[model samples]
Target chain A: GAGVSQSPSNKVTEKGKDVELRCDPISGHTALYWYRQSLGQGLEFLIYFQGNSAPDKSGLPSDRFSAERTGGSVSTLTIQRTQQEDSAVYLCASSPESNGFPNRGETQYFGPGTRLLVL
Target chain B: GESVGLHLPTLSVQEGDNSIINCAYSNSASDYFIWYKQESGKGPQFIIDIRSNMDKRQGQRVTVLLNKTVKHLSLQIAATQPGDSAVYFCAERGGLDMRFGAGTRLTVKP
Candidate 1:
């Protein structure tokens, strides 16, 4: 039982700088997802990875946002040339193996999240 | 370009009272719905979920109701407690990703 974990609880960086946020899913979780939450806003899907299948990057707002899950456990979300609009709480979540459809009752456990502030 | 949305942005209820949160989604194809509760400085925690096939689902002190015809969803908390005060969000999965609605902040008054 350790839930999902994210590193660098808070990050403040200059605009145009690159930042990398890391996430460690639950021990055996095979699905990892990244989301962004702006001030007073809801969670915005960024990307998702399940096992060895191709990562679903449809949610990525722009090409500057990218993510990778290595060895099927850890995932990193990298933002290149960050913008002030990218400032938000980046949340990571995980769940057990399923048909890739979260609607099927696969509960996603989330981490504390890494707050990013782009100056 | 469908999205999930909440009818109200805030709700206040007395402790031990029943609390109901409402949500509306635009995508008719969405088949799964979930409710999440998030406290300040924390990530969202799964509260309850309901499949489109079912009209209602109950768990613990929480119940989730889905109306496919109206594309509406609601989460009801029975005997609301102080611990239930938080921002609640509803999400719907239609395509490869799920869309989350702007959260509703719940305040439990003692």
Candidate 2:
């Protein structure tokens, strides 16, 4: 659409199960980011993808979290063996810059976010 | 630990009054700063941004000030209204890395 869109606006899964969240960024935005917002907490950076290159996975929180950007357009964040702590709102944002930005990525547009609840 | 914090987690301001939200970031290398507003059930929406090269930037009804000397950032909303009530976040970017602060809940009391 016109802005970033995230899938599974709300997900309820059992502990130890796996879940995948999707994101569709605005057209022509080369930079995409994933973040997690826990209850009564701030947004935590998860991953950053610039175009089709290897994404920055430093913020995945654990090895169970991984993400991939296909064709530099849509992205999916997969969490294996989910835990109660994984319950949070998964947010996605897109910009024209790579984080250290000036060309356009400086102002990122975020999605509505996916609320995940692990039982 | 790298973090961004605020002295007050919540602020109440009267309608039509000016509101100022502050942020203290721990990263000294951070050179770019941004302010975002996130309403309930919504993601953060960009407000304004200032680069390390400059200290201040102004936008529609909003202004962002960056004080590198003390590692502080502030957002000023002119004529604050009920529509401006939301959670405000301060984010910093350095060397291709971006981070967000805890955030401040702004309540515009009408």
Question: How well does each candidate reproduce the native contacts, as fnat?
Answer: 0.56, 0.54
What 10-residue stretch in candidate 1 chain B is worst by lDDT? B1-10
| DockQ of every candidate | 0.46, 0.46
Q: What is the Cα-based lDDT of residue B60 in candidate 2?
A: 96
Quote the positional error of residue A111 for candidate 2 in Å: 0.7
| Candidate 2 stretches greater than 4 Å from native | A97-105, B1-8
Best by TM-score: 2
Candidate 2 reaches a DockQ of: 0.46
Clashing residue pairs in candidate 2 (N, C-alpha, C atoms within 3 angstroms): A97-A105
> In model 1, which regions exceed 4 Å deviation?
A99-105, B1-8
Q: What lDDT tens digits, residue by residue, belong to model 2 across residues A12-68?
A: 999999999999999988888899988657788888888865446778899999999
lDDT of 2 at A23: 99
